[model samples]
Target: MSVTALYTDLSGYYDLMCADIDYREQSNYVRRLHELFGNQGKNVLDLACGTGPHLRHFIDFGYTASGVDINQPMLDIAQLRCPEAQFTQQDMSDLNMDAQMDLISCFLYSIHYNQSIATLTDCIASVHRALKPGGLFCFNAVDKSTIDNRAGIKRQLTHDQSNFSFQSNWYYSGEGEQQQLQLSIERTTNGITEHWRDQHAMVALTFAHLQQLLEPYFEVHILAHDYERIAPWENAAGNAFFVAIKH
Candidate 1:
């Protein structure tokens, strides 16, 4: 899909498409990260914080939380959903927060949205700049399993609300970088059919690559399996979450 169509399509069903995410579980993950720091600090900056679902947890935990996202509509919904917290419309790489943060989170494979390696490197460097000395930075990336195990040539999921249904047919390029998806969505009440053909490019980096990129700036632990701590190679199966403390 063209960039314009990509933005329009996502804006139309952003909430409906992401309704299945377990926000409580995700928030717990963030809270656990903070708990690891003990008495170190109390402020957080959530980058690419879509819908601000995770920010609520930090606020409830008594930490001052602020969120930033590139999409305006998403930021609007986040602002409304989290009126108590600060939400700004901005690109992650371009952020310039006057205050340093104790924690920074970019979750849910949002880092891969950067289309190029240079941009990805810049994002990491920017995170390093935004964090305080010894502050924690955490983010997740798509495991190659997501590419290898990808199937479901054609699928239809009917959300009880007929107007909010999800349907897609997908197949990936052998390299796993390119994905071809044909999406057909319908709003039963309005009888509006929104059709889109999307080609998304992704880069799946390994633990080794990420380690090399972050070591200079951080003391890192790779959480290959569970959320709380990094396990040995035995459990380093599919997904991995990297937690790095700025040095």
Candidate 2:
């Protein structure tokens, strides 16, 4: 499906499908980063910031926030939801902003949307260029090993005023750095069934791979792994979040 159609078709049930994703906790983590690094008079750039849910968290922490995403429908939701922050519909690999920001964040494994290694490196480089000296770049990626071992994972979850029942199925190839996630969600609204599907190709990049690629522009740090949080594999939950400091 076309990118526009993907976002447009799912816009109606997007919120419902993702109501239990715990964006608030993720946002709070970002706010903590801002606090640790001093966010006063600093700007934040949220790359691939879908619906700006995380952007709202940074704004609450007293940082001027801006975001960019290629999906216009999602950007529209973000703009409406967080009018105080600026949201732009732009590709992650070739984002052009006025100046470098203090912090640049690509959260929720959003960086995996880039289907190629070159594009992934370029996306990281673009964020590197968008940050000032000593600026921090944070992002998350899915570990290939975790996806290969686990697929067809289902969970029944509920949110405020809504119910989220989803099956997380993914295809991962151990031979290369390519993976696909099919998030099949069924929402119950007043006992009615509403279904939505989000197919995402989550590019897998090793910690060393990214660190080597970003060494020229950033001092990379592997913050944490998704160990025991999502799957049974030791240190293999398909999510490796890291922070890199720009020189």
Candidate 3:
């Protein structure tokens, strides 16, 4: 699949569009999670590492980090941001690595790009194969309940020189096994306006389904909205953070 304008033409504006996200705090949380659940070593692989913000902080946190993204333009920016770390262009489902990592993290809900249960399973199994024994795979995901709750929501961000708005709507398709998201993005800069409409499809995997899929390859541990470890049923309606240890 070709890279969309959202990731290519709009790649430079991604950080600005998400200016509210505290990468430092998020990276600290991830580091803490790794400390609690990761192996002794600090070899880390960040999947779908857009612009390398987290990897920059991971390097600061004293980990040897590498990043992989399918988009070259995004990887280019990431290289400039984190020059010390290695970067690769690869699909998450077909992840290949020469050396195993102690920890692998895919953040920012990038797993949704898998678009199918089969591809998502392939990505997870690939991560399992790329990890050393007892290595950790940590990621964040939005379940169907949360997606349904937030459907048709509009979010906007404004900076000094530009204004950006995003509206999202999701619906079930194909016998309820697939979910499709339609995103409308509008940007205004220096009196110039651009509008882009993008569609993303993902497998509608519930919390229970996710647990079942990971059971064969990992010991799954789920966390709540605040990134603290919790039972899966505790925060069943919100975003979930997963820490799965390879068996």
lDDT of 2 by residue, 1-247 (tens): 3123335666655665566677777766655554555334468989988888888878887778999998888889988889999888898988899888998988867787777788888887788788887888877766665565454767676665667676766667676877676777777768888877776766776656766888888876665544223222235345666767777
| Every candidate's CA RMSD | 3.5, 4.3, 2.5
Local distance difference test, per candidate?
0.68, 0.73, 0.82
Give the per-residue lDDT digits (tens) of candidate 1, residues 1-247: 4232333446646566666677767767767866775237888888988778788777877888889887787777777877887888877866778788899988876776664556667778888998989898887765443455344334344555455455544434556343344444545545655555554444555567767878989888877645555453344465577788898
Ranking by TM-score: 3, 2, 1
Global CA lDDT computed for model 1: 0.68
The per-residue C-alpha lDDT of model 1 at residue 185 equals: 50
| Residue 143, candidate 2: C-alpha displacement in angstroms | 2.0
Model 3 C-alpha RMSD to native: 2.5
Total clashing pairs for each candidate: 0, 1, 0
TM-scores of the candidates are: 0.81, 0.82, 0.89
Per TM-score, the best of the predicted structures is 3
Evaluate model 2: give its TM-score: 0.82
Could you tell which candidate, 1 or 2, scores higher by lDDT?
Answer: 2
For candidate 3, lDDT tens digit of each residue in 1-247?
A: 3226767877887676566678887788888877877778899999999899999999999999999998888999999999999999999899989899999998877877787899999998999999999999988877775566345767788877778897767665436556766778898999898898877666677777888889999999888756443345366555788889999
Alpha carbon lDDT of residue 38, candidate 2? 33
